[model samples]
Target: MVLAAACTALGLWQLDRRDQAAATVSTVQANYDREPIAYDPSLFDTYEESREWMPVEMTGTYDSANQRIVRNRPLNGRPGYEVLVPLRLQDGTAVVINRGWLPIGNREAGHPDEVPQAPEGEVTVTARIRPGEPVLNRSAPEGQLASIDLAGYGAQLDYPMHAAAYGLLASESPAPATTPVAPAKPAIDLGPHLSYSMQWFAFGVLLFVGFGYAVRQQYRLDHEDELDAPAPVRTRRRPSSEEEEDAILDARGL
Candidate 1:
């Protein structure tokens, strides 16, 4: 019973997590398929789910001097780097733009140094809706230049930045002549928690069923020896030969 209760409590806890995850996914989906809202990019400084897929337009001058190359990127199965440049909007707010991908060159030239340059001055650009950078499995070591965290990226470049780590810029869509690629978006998968809840519930049932079999086996074994036996005498057992003689002499008062 205790085991069953504990399992049930755990199942309930997982269910709660499942619900929260579903709601988050739903909110993102709704935001994605809808039209753009003229919201300040500040709303996404913290990467809220509601702001996901909200198509945003910002007119800004890009800072190309401090551009970053997101290494180990993939574009249509080709190895590449995601060009990251900071955009200072007309109103003086900074937002990071993921200006699409750049195919990494052969080791002869090392990483490509001839990636497209973001023009200076106010350049109006559109960014398809997205959230922060993907969590890389093996990111660069602290303060190392290979690949850096968003905050550290800003710090390394001496940036006066605002909100989120990455944004795929509108002007950088893949062309037919180049490797096919899709723009980056926040990681939004949320079904695994619900699947886990089901597994826990199934395990709880198996525990109850196995315990019942054990109890039934014990009961059957306890009663097995009695099926063919007669009832035992309630009185004490009869005396042996010497005891009987003693009893007879005592009866004659010897």
Candidate 2:
């Protein structure tokens, strides 16, 4: 019983995980389905995770001189860097834009890989808001970071910055060709949680069935000798004296 209960508890835990994953996938789908809203920096003065992946549009000039790079971003199995450039708004506040990935050149030759420059003038950007990533404890080249840490970058820039990073989707720039390739949309795969739940439930059922079968077999074994033993023999008994006297009188014809 204890083993069965444990298996059942595990199955319930998996089921809960499955439900949570489904809900997350549903939320992601809904976020993409809705039309984009105009981005207002003040609306995100206090960061909210729910706002992540919300499509937004804004027009700003790129601060090319204060650009930063996020090291080691991989796309299509090729390692690269994500260019993080601050887009200066008219109000003097800045927001980090993840331009996209850039391939690494051969390191042995000390090859100076050139980073493509952002456009010269104000450009209207259509992008999805992404939550700022946590800072990892790793070293990189100067003007490069380990992840998207908005507060960290704000400190580095010595200026106010939006709390979230905007992932570039499309831009209307004078030099269309200068735009960096946009990152792919976030994945909405439901993952293996559902299958894991089913497996756990199967294990719980098997435990109960196996335990019952083992108990029945043990009981049958304990009574095996008694079941196979032979039956006891019986003997005939003599009649009473009154019955014998009656029988003799009848035989004498008196």
For this target, which candidate reaches the highest TM-score against the unseen true structure?
2
Model 2 Cα shift for residue 207 (angstroms): 0.8
| Tens digits of per-residue lDDT for model 1, 2-88 | 787777788788889888877777776776556645537565477766665666766667787777777777766877677677877
The C-alpha stretches of model 2 lying farther than 4 A from their native spots are 108-114, 175-180, 220-224, 227-254
Best by lDDT: 2
Residues 1-254, candidate 2: write the lDDT tens digits.
67767867887887788777777677678776578788787544655556666777777888899998788788889877788888888888877878777777676321127677888789877666677778889877778888887878888877788865555554545545554556676678777866786787788789878888999899889999987899888987897899899999999996
TM-score of each: 0.64, 0.78
> Which residue pairs in model 2 clash with each other?
none
Candidate 2 total steric clashes: 0
Residue 244 shift from truth in candidate 2, angstroms: 11
**Whole-model Cα lDDT per candidate?**
0.66, 0.74
